[model samples]
Target: MTNMSAAAAGPNATYNFKVVLLGEGCVGKTSLLLRYIEDKFNDKHLTTLQATFLNKKININGKRINLAIWDTAGQEKFHALGPIYYRNSNGAILVYDITDEDSFGKVKNWVKELRKMLGSEIVLIIAGNKIDLEHERTVPLEEAESYANMVGAKHFYTSAKLNQGVEELFLELTQEMVERFEQNSQTDLNRTQRVLVVDDEAPVQSSCCTGSKTN
Candidate 1:
């Protein structure tokens, strides 16, 4: 994470993170991305072909962060290409339609694939989309929450059509990514400092013997 002061030095230092949206077709993955990026939604179904990319810039605690979001194609044919788009993603949004139980099951499969390829380090959020249709929902919120906890991911209900819980979801994920990056950076810095101290002490120990020999 870039320091808030870094933004004052010149232009706001921008931190870029790649985030991918994954789920089955018609699960509102595209709608969620569209609502977040463009603040608009359509009733007609728009199936993603290969993948769609969108960039959103936000400020987190005075630091600039850019989320490069990828809305992936969820059809079976495009399944193999999912790993390609999310190869080095910093985070992921695993979406599912709350009204469709099958979609929720597919979310699990997507989570498994992500874990297998990216490991547990990638920040994950399980989005139960279509919350507007809660009256017809087949998957219970508790079930989704339990699965999210089991997989070490956060879960939230979202309704892109109504623009509810969309912004907060992305903001929370971005914050998590920033925190993770900062923690990893601090760990690396501590390790480097320890190595430098060891290297400096070696020369001091070696020079002490040389001074004794001269005496």
Candidate 2:
């Protein structure tokens, strides 16, 4: 969906966008973010603090968009930390393990919490992960899709093990963020230029005073 590569944003320009990943424990949230950011997935089930950070870059519409992904712990113990990660996020991926009925059941709770803390402007994506283990699948595709539709989120089924649809799901979210940034950047550009002009003029005026005295 990103028409332009990140390289096109030039060597000096950097766009930082923030996104958060949420779901019940062992739903592959860390695996999905790791796979997307480093192209590697680990079997390790390390406990993340209230939140963990990951970074990645991609080209969209010929511009570089840098993603700051916050992977939060899904355990109930980390519930108080939810708002800490949700605030100021541009997008979110509500992940669930396809083989875990308990994880799937928590999707609505995650969404509701996010809405209460993060609000409606943030983009949301519903991700059903662990699709490679077809035999262990417990959540039906149609049901997940229906839930996503109800919440107006783009839905995806992925396998962190096989690396299926993991990148695709992230690309969709990045595309949405890039589109929003582009729309808002016109005003941002003008504001930046105005600040630049003011800074330069102040120095120029001081230099003119010294030059006039010398003459």
Candidate 3:
């Protein structure tokens, strides 16, 4: 629920989205986040204790959007708390290491949990990370992409070390969230208009009945 916008946002940022990062430990969830938000990468692996929050602002087309990203701990001990971070998220990035088949399986479990807890309305993206070590990859691109398609999620191969597809992934999710928000708003407006039309007709029908009775 914290807002993160650039100083230049001023009044242009009309859309705000809460995005959560989920993955197995050492899958580079934190690395991917840092690459997108800070544009920095470290070779050392550091385990997240609980969860970290970051706020970043970006412009999509002509509209400004703020992304509040939550990086959660990937350790098994913290698995039970995943809902605390992702519950009400506008979008989720489910990451897995390309070199680790086990991590990919973990990603699938996370997807199931998110869907069960947050429902299908949450925008999901499957990220096959550590693509920089493609030579050591155990999970094939075709396999990952196929799973993503089956689950109706976007798929991207990213390497936080090389800063590949990190920005594009976030931007795509942000745009999707904005489009969904606008669509929902329009639907509400249309429903209100329909109700008003019905109300207007009700009064006309009453007046017509009164006139007929007088005749």
The best candidate in terms of TM-score: 1
lDDT of 1 by residue, 1-215 (tens): 22211222345577788999999999999999999999999999999999989999889887798888999999989998987898888899999999889989999998998888878778999999998998999998899999999999999899999999999999999988877776666777799999998987744444344445552
Candidate 3 lDDT tens digits, 1-215: 22222323244546778999999999999999999989999999978988999999878788877788999999999999988898778899999999999999999998998888777678899999988999999998899999999998999999999999998899888877777666666766799999998987744443444445552
Worst 10 residues of 3 by lDDT: 1-10
Count clashing residue pairs per candidate: 0, 4, 0
- Rank by TM-score, descending? 1, 3, 2
C-alpha-based local distance difference test score of model 1 = 0.87
Better of 1 and 3 by lDDT: 1
Candidate 2: tens digits of C-alpha lDDT, residues 1-215: 11222222355555677898989888889888878887897888856778989788777665667888999998899877887787788888999988998898898888887777656657899999988887989888889899899887899999887899998999999888766655556656789999998887744344345445552
Stretches of candidate 2 exceeding 4 Å from the true structure: 1-13, 183-215
lDDT of 3: 0.86
- Displacement of residue 42 (Cα, Å) in model 3 is 1.1
After superposing candidate 1, which stretches have Cα over 4 Å from the reference? 1-12, 201-215
